[model samples]
Target: MHYVKAKGILSAKNGMNLYRGCSHGCIYCDSRSKCYHMEHEFEDIEIKENAIELLEIALKHKRKKCMIGTGAMTDPYIPLEMELGHIRKAMALVCEYGHGFTVITKSSRILRDIDLLKKINDTTKCVVQMTMTTYDEELCRKIEPNVSTTRERFEVLKELHGAGIPAVVWLSPILPFINDTEENILGILDYCARAEVYGVICFGMGLTLRDGNREYFYRQLDRSFPGMKEKYIRKYGDQYMIESPNSRKLMALFHEICRQNEMLHDNAQIFAYLNTFEEKYAGRQLSIFDL
Candidate 1:
């Protein structure tokens, strides 16, 4: 890991990534695509030195309180977070400023900040979004080797529900001919149902592969699942959106299950929920005596 000073923190839409690059070693990470133009290796995380200071400045100056999102370009709860504590500091600032918070992550390390998350939700909103692509533990391990397994993430969702914090599941990037199966989709949906997640965001049953990520994926395939890269080349020959042949069947089942469970399945609606911030009550003001 290396540190660099950041000029600013929040995006125009009130999102921030305290770090660049990741160590999670997911075989199909889109962030590795050359289009992103990272100067360093993907594993060499770049830490933003002044992120917390910039966030405090931005939050203090904002006219209205809205959801402050992180973990989009990079997961905030990466293992490095345990040492740096940037995410913890940022969320504390959000809570102090009475702003809503949301994060998208695949790491159970987020549990470390459950108290702050619950504190933020008690007065405003705090949503935890987790990605669950493969339900089979073994297959999930093969794909997302460095992060929390599907079952661990499911448990995290349940815990978040217990804390009165809503959770959303991102069921996406399902590898074709590998994990694109009825059983896999059903298993993940079952977990979502059991966790009582607020929504499930799925953009059909497929994964996208571009120049940089596609080459890396194919290399990983060569190492882990021999001959699979040749199959992908023969079929998807440089195509961007590599969809599953069983996409229609899988999508039909996905919609039917979500409808039955009364969960939000539409991407737009879910995004709206994540972006919208509702202030539940007036924040308590500090009195001189208390101080």
Candidate 2:
């Protein structure tokens, strides 16, 4: 890892990525795609030196407190977090300042900050979003090599539910001819149901491919599942969306299951939930004694 002072921290929408690049080694990670234009290797993380201070300044000056998002570009609970404790520090700031927070990760390591997450949610909102692409533990391990398996993430979701923290599941990038099957979707949905997740976000039953990510993915495919790259090349020569043939059937099942379970399946609705924030300490003044 290397440190560099950031020019700014928060995005126009109040999202922040305290680090650049990742070490989780998800084979289908879009962040590693060429379009993102990272100057360093993907495994070599870039730490933002002044991220905490920048966040403090932005939050203090904001007229309204909305959900502060992270882990969109890179998972905040990467292995480095175990050593750095930066994400926990950020959570402490968010809780102390009374701001809502959300994170999208595939790591069970997020459990380390459960206390702060509950603190934020008790007053405002704190959503824990995790991705579950493959239900089978072995397959999940191969694809999301360095991160927690889907079962481990399921346990995290259940624990979050127990803490009264809402959880969202991303069931996406479902590689075609690999995991694009009825069993895969059903298994993940079963996990979501048992965990009592607030929602499940799925963009059909396939994954995307582009210049940088496509090449790297194909290389991994060749190494792990020999001759699969040829099948992909033969079928989706240069496509981006890459939806699976089973999308229609699987989507029918997806909507049906979510509808029955009362989980949020609408992408727009779920995004709104993640972006929405309520101030717990609004219009309250600190007493001189308390101050």
Candidate 3:
């Protein structure tokens, strides 16, 4: 890891990535695409030395107390986080400024900050978002080798729910001919249901492949699945969005199961909920006059 001074921290939409690049080693990572323009190797994380300071400045000056999100391009709970504690400091700033917090992570390391998460949620809102790609533990290990297993993430979700903090799951990058089966989708949705997640964000039953990630994904497929690279090339040559042939059926089952479970399945609706900040404890404190 290397440190660099950042010019700014928060994006216009109130999102920030305290670290750049990732070590998770997920084969289908879109952040590896050339469009993102990273100068360093993906695993050699870049730490924004000024992120927490800039975030504090931004949060203090903001007139509205909306949600502040992180972990979009890189998971905040990366193993390096345990050493740096940048995410913890940032969450403290968000709570100090009375803004909501949300993070998308695939690691159970987030459990380390459960107390702060609950503290933020008790006043405003704190939503924990996790990604679940493959349902089978062995398959998940192969696909998301460096991150938490699906069962571990499920446990994190259940713990978040027990703490009265809402959780959302990103059921994404469903590799065609891999984990795109109805059983895989059903298994993940069942986990979500059991965890009492507020929503499951799925953009159909396929993953996207682009220049940087496509080559890496094919390389990993050749190493792991054997002959999968040729199949992908023959099926989706130069295509960005590689949708599964059973996308229609898988998506139908997805919506139906989520509907039955009374969970939010629409991507747009889920995004709206994630972006909307709620002041759950507004006006709850007794005033000095009352005392």
What's the distance in Å from true for residue 111, model 1? 0.5
lDDT of 3 by residue, 1-291 (tens): 999999999999999999999999998999999899999999999999989889988998999989999999999999999999999999999998889999999999999999999999988889999999999999998989999999999999999999998999999989999998989999999999999999999987898888898888988998899999999889999899999999999999999999999999988998999999877545353356555
- Model 1 CA deviation exceeding 4 Å by range: 282-291
Candidate 2 deviant stretches above 4 angstroms:
280-291
Against the reference, the lDDT scores of all candidates come to: 0.93, 0.90, 0.93
Ranking by TM-score: 3, 1, 2
Candidate 3: list runs displaced more than 4 Å. 282-291
How many residue pairs clash in each candidate at the backbone level? 0, 0, 0
Evaluate model 3: give its lDDT. 0.93
Please report how far candidate 2 places residue 62 from its true position, in Å: 1.0
- Residue pairs with backbone overlap in model 1: none
Ranking by lDDT: 1, 3, 2
Per-residue lDDT, model 1, residue 230, is 94
TM-score of each: 0.96, 0.95, 0.96
With candidate 1 superimposed using the best TM-score fit, by how many Å does residue 282's alpha carbon deviate from the native? 7.6
Question: What is the Cα-based lDDT of residue 32 in candidate 2?
Answer: 86
lDDT of 2: 0.90
**Could you give candidate 1's per-residue lDDT for residues 16-125 as a string of tens digits?**
99999998989999988999888898899999999999999999999998999998889888899999999999999999998999999999999999999999998899
Better of 2 and 3 by lDDT: 3
